[model samples]
Target: MGELFNRFHATRRNRRRFWLSILIFSSTVLFLFLVFFVKRHEQKSLSYSQVEPDSCVRLHEVSGVYRIRSERNRGRIWFATAQGLYELDTLRNQWQRFGPDQGLGSDKVYDVAFIDEIPWAVTRRGCNRYNAKRGRFEMVAPGSKLDRAPLILIEEMEPEGVFFGVDGGELYRLASLQAKPERIPIPDGNDDARITCLKKIGEMLYIGIENGWLYAYDPRNGSFHRYVFGRPLSPHAYLWDVVLFKGNLWVATSENGLYRQEQTGEDTLKPVKGFPAKGAFAFALEEDGFWCGTPFGLWRYHARQDAWIQFVHPREKQPTDFQVLTLFNEKDRLWFGSLENGCGYLNKRNLEWVTAFPSLSRPNAAALAADDSLVWVGFGYQGGFTNAYSSDALQKIKAYEASDDILEQSIQCFTLSNHRLFYGGYEGFGYLNMATGEYDHYSARRFPEIADITDIAVSPSQGLYYLAGAFGVVAYYADKDSLASFSETRRYRTTALYAEGDTLWAGTLSHGVLVIDRKSGQLLARMDGVSSRVMGLFGRPDNPDLLLATKEKGCYRLQKSTLRMESVDIPDKVLPGGCQQYENNIMTAKGMGNLFWVGTRFRGAVVYDENIRQWKRVTSQQGLLGNQIRAFAQSDRYIWIGTYGGVTRFHKPYLSRLLDIVL
Candidate 1:
């Protein structure tokens, strides 16, 4: 009986083993099938993202302009815009922009001048001379005496010389292109005084000072004379412009209106009648009379009637609100640069207004975000509206202006979470519910500490959002509808934030980067030595490593395992014509599959392909709207670039294919 029992137990054990083997085989097959299905689905989706070659890159819209420079002899007009320098092609009716990528010293051109038929531009950093043969702006006196100084104005002197004014009220004269700039001593120079404008009439050079004084320098005799309006020592006055109109010296001032003085007489300065009492910024000489630009509008001084007539916009019905900053007169038109309204031209014969180049309305593109269906772009200060574009139809764009509900007009950064769009701007943080089409805003009025929102990061697993700005870092609990700050984030000037698994990275203005343990709210690591001001941190879409972008240190990659930072090598060809230092001027960096994209404040955008180890650049020459890239976003099919000029879309697959063919 014992033997029979053992036989029955063995048979039952064998049957149990067979059933376990069958179960294991079925589970393995199911897992394999799921993996295959997912891979195939990804391939199908990628194929759908491919676009045609003709639609590889397209410009959607243009931003408003700030200043205008005309070269009537060449039949070209140069626009000194926030984007860069744009030359209007009258024959084609198109605008061509030049930036660092196009070989300019910098993209932020404050003033432009043509001396000896050569175009020269003065940037906040230094001065650049345009090379017509090479079609690029070459830096003048780089790392020399003229370097590392903020140039405010540039004007041609008598005979064949140019004068440049530094922000510190020092004046330098360039006798020729090959000659070194010689310092021209100011009589009783005040270090606090700044040179605003310079004009030359006959043998005299008229220099306008922000201290409300106009200096008349006789270049031939080396004599200096100062002219003052109001009190001789009035500190409230500011001289904006100096010009010669109808053999009379005309001066525009910030405190007083317009002043006119005869060339030969008692030289008594008299204020022009029927002009704005304040904020007279610029002037232009006309045949019949003179043109004055003020805060109110453009005014024409009729010589025959001695009466003033204000030119109003046909559409607005009110006087043109363009705060004209500079003026240029052509044979038949008057060009005026505005403080916010881009630039305008008036027909001299009919006294009609012409909207030459409409302002981008929003000058600085601050933040960019995109999903599968739409792209959202935010602007910086004075940027009147936020722009949106449909991913499927990029030509269709919409603008969101500030209203009673939307208090913030300047957006600094944006993020997407829970099917909603969240933005941080001049005032505070806000969110738009995509499903409900509802808008909700929060500002310093509610949370006084949260002002000047610069960057944002969302934690999906923890159901929280992180905001970084002037006040450091703050946490928003979506469930609790509350904002709080952690001890680790205090006392740090954080400008940007990024979230990863179990860790949050905070980019500071001067302290480098701070890595914190999200769960414990404790600082884990402080990554220094990358840059003084870290602009952004991004993770590679295909890899676990991280990239850090900075203001002057270029870009660096942080290894996930070792956390060691390594500098990424940028191709020299990406920025030709002595613009190699511009690699460190990176503002934003993003990664996709095997390509890394970088955006700069001046040098447009660059894409590095990891597969073939190549770099490709896009600027105005390559059909981009502008070269000053403020923000960048990538969808599955397209890469969106937010520039000072407008929003540009690039088809990823087509670009990749084109690069392959070129390489």
Candidate 2:
């Protein structure tokens, strides 16, 4: 009987082991199938994220290089752009930019030159000298005679002399930094002509003027001679560029070919034979001969071949020949700048191209964000570039150019969450993952649908991105990868939004602000007396308990917890359009002070200082890039102003301290 019981127990144990092994094997097979399926799906969208950036969005390397000045003695190279000034750091091989924030007279810089190792910038507003010790610019403060006259040109000659041309038909010499400017009279028949080019060779100052006139003047002996070009050009063709190369005088003309000095007795210039005209504009010298930049392409005077060689042709490599504005010989590289977007250098040793300076790929810098080592910018709105640039030593990381890809949209704001860049634009709202670049924007193609986001904001503490406009307020939770939108009221025409700890401030089209609770989706408060079409709403770093709201007509300060509202202190001299004008739904500046900047259309920017309780207006009258403000980008230490003219960077000296207050 005991032997029968043991045999039955052993048989039962064997059956249990058989069933357990079968179940384990089936589970393993199922796990492998699911893993394979998920990975295959991820590969299609995420393959390029680890190795490269998107092919649709790329680093735009051009920002209109208008002038170049190399202060070799100080190992400093200065580049003038349509926006502002850039100083090349040879040690790091990077360009350090300076604009209106650095007290520059204007960002539309006409020329940049270093006299006596001190950098001087000339702009449409006037001339300014860099005070290295102060780390800013001081306007060559208008003297009594100038009377805020617009500056047309500046000329610097050897033996410690700098000359400036004013619009009142007067030439003044600034003897020294301290001495007052003294008027230097020119010869007869020159008052009405616009000076185009100024070249000083030995003691003779060669002056080229528009309306076909050239004058050679001697400042020491008061001797001068004037000549006019009657051939190869119209009577009004401006003498563009005059340079002394290979011990001979060469001049460039916009109408036809280059003019070379033919005889010692002839003050007249004759067009060089067998030279390609191509609308010569600027000159850069090489060891053998020289290079002339033109509207058509880049032409080099091959001294060995004695023929003009077309080095870079337009349409050969994506519209390179769109008017080469300036060229320079820096070390072993030949640097050339274009009228709009072609600014780069050609390596003489390897014959490769390198574009420097991290400016806008297009005209308007719509939005800006920083991710680790890369700074990303999105271009859109009026200028119609519909492009963006991510810069790391000016590499072409990605490009977004096709009609289907661009869709002519403009990015209004950007916020990063979970390694993804969430952007809102006039077109729509989308997120760009480092692992997944957006494509076919509206259709999306395997990606999630982009929200209808005309404007948006973010809350770092809550890990939430707030989406407004048409759909009301939508909160995207980054951690859960989910979206929670409060679409109860579609009537909320939210023009601006600001998210604090537990509250979200939404400024609407009317002169009212709606305060909402983040957790409950409850309407907390409502305030009135704000300007219509509320444009700006944000919490200040200095006072997190208060909110600042801006509108087309004026501004108001609101209490966060109590929902109290008050009118901002307006300075009498803030130029009629600022706190009192309608403009800017943007961020402000920190670091230097509790500073808030309001961008205007005609007035550059109106700034309010919380600490000092004061206001000041900045414009081209001060040192801005342009008077027409289009867009704005704010980083940790800089506020970027994008205008119809160009872009400018303003520094915030005390940004670090502001964080301490908020924390």
Candidate 3:
């Protein structure tokens, strides 16, 4: 009986073991499936997060490169990336960036061009023209009409009109100041063909289509002719750029080396010898030689010898090489813009080689400003110092000699007018003479203790200059503008000051917007709808509405006398338009011609077209530093930017879609 019981127990035990094994196997399978699902979700989330940076964007320090450019003045370079449009600055081998929060038309600038001496920036939609007169942007047209979406390629027709190239290969021109744009026919044979390049040489309009076919149009006779390259190199001949140099037309292609056709010959193009290895992506004509910035590096064409000399910057180890896409000659030095890398600089006299600030990555600076007299760079900052560069040439001028305890050596804003140098910075206010280098401080006990002075504006109507700071708004008499601080009777942390006739508009950090009577230090009208942290203030010279950049609520268009406020919608993708910085929105405003450049803290910068009511953002893809902009200033030649990374400067319109696809 005992043996029979033992056998039954063993059988039961074996069954139990079999069931346990099955359970374990099922559990392990489930666990593996769960892990795989979680990983897939994480990857999707990471990609989505990259699509839009968090409100509090943190910039990581990468690397640095020494950039030396002989050119002193190019316009402030504007860049567009997957993130936004940015004003980059490069100084002391550092990089920085400025975007929407600071002040720009939009956060996505695809291309930029200069028309009527004004900058016209392209976006996904239409185009915007900078109105330097009113200090704002005026959209040339609404972009909604093009069924093609905003992938626009814009170029200037020299003195006046502008040319727009759509993705479908249709060309349109904003020839007149009419409300709507005019569409120009590209001749019947081209079909709805895509235009690869458009250039105006002397009196002829040159258009390049897919494959190696070139066409020339005589606007006077309405005659069109196609120039064919004898051999077929590119499946679709794509012309990238065309320029008139050395009595000949230099044509750059996507597959073939540089092609040249005599100005008199309408149908002949021969490849320039030395650049045989690669096709030209972008090129700039300097004195006698042509500087070719190909996908490889920088190449100089010696017209005398008819040869190409590739130039690369000197670095400690093997310097980072990139596809040079653009070139600018500042003060005789050469600056190259890379499509993937950043910018490159070569000092011909010193043979000093350098790249854009934060040179390790895509700090591509699209524009350049250069002059024999001065060099101004705009970029971001990496470690400590901001990326605003002032050439040793300008530093030698000794604008202000206030060698004595100059109110905070850190300069926030600087302006030179009528031979007088004005600086607004951490200290209070100061003035210096370019000739004498005599400097004086204006922050004394007489005025309420002011923290950092952010901005100083000289009234166009009145000679008086308005001082804005952390304290309150203060006005100093024009002629007696010495280092004497105003009496402490009035103190307000003012960030911006604008004047119209006798009325002065002030945007403060804590006190809302104040309209002060310039003559008397008394406040006239004050608006407190939003907070006192008014960042950007622009008084439309003709319109009664005042444009105010606020801290949280995007931008406000305040009615002149009524104080009625209207909120402007910032792009959903970009929030807190400026960098999500805890400090006061360190944005700036400058107007040249008809365009207004608004520098922001985080959103980088945007160009606003008051006429079209459009916005454009500049970003790193377009060759800006990063997106954290600190300040914006326009020198006689280039627009300057102060940022967290370093400094970057561009000489032309910058638009690169690759930045959006990449991080």
In lDDT terms, which candidate is top?
Answer: 1
lDDT of each: 0.70, 0.62, 0.56
In the range 344-461, model 1's lDDT, one tens digit per residue, is 6778789888765322335466677888887777777754466665675442245567864553677877887888888888688888876787777888778755677788788877
Number of the candidate with higher TM-score, 1 or 2: 2
Judged by whole-model lDDT over C-alpha atoms, candidate 1 comes out at: 0.70
Sort by lDDT, top down from the best: 1, 2, 3
Q: Best TM-score goes to which candidate?
A: 2
Clashing pairs in 1: 63-359, 63-360, 63-645, 64-359, 64-360, 65-342, 65-359
Better of 1 and 3 by lDDT: 1
RMSD of each: 25.3, 27.5, 16.5
lDDT, candidate 2, 523-560, per-residue tens: 76667666476666656544844545454555567777
Residue runs of model 3 more than 4 Å from their true location after superposition: 1-108, 143-152, 158-160, 188-191, 314-320, 354-663
Ranking by TM-score: 2, 1, 3
Which stretches of model 2 miss by more than 4 angstroms?
1-65, 97-101, 144-147, 167-170, 225-233, 263-266, 313-321, 349-361, 368-377, 380-412, 416-446, 450-462, 466-476, 480-663
Q: Give the TM-score of candidate 3.
A: 0.44
Better of 1 and 3 by TM-score: 1
Task: Estimate the overall C-alpha local distance difference test score of candidate 2.
Answer: 0.62
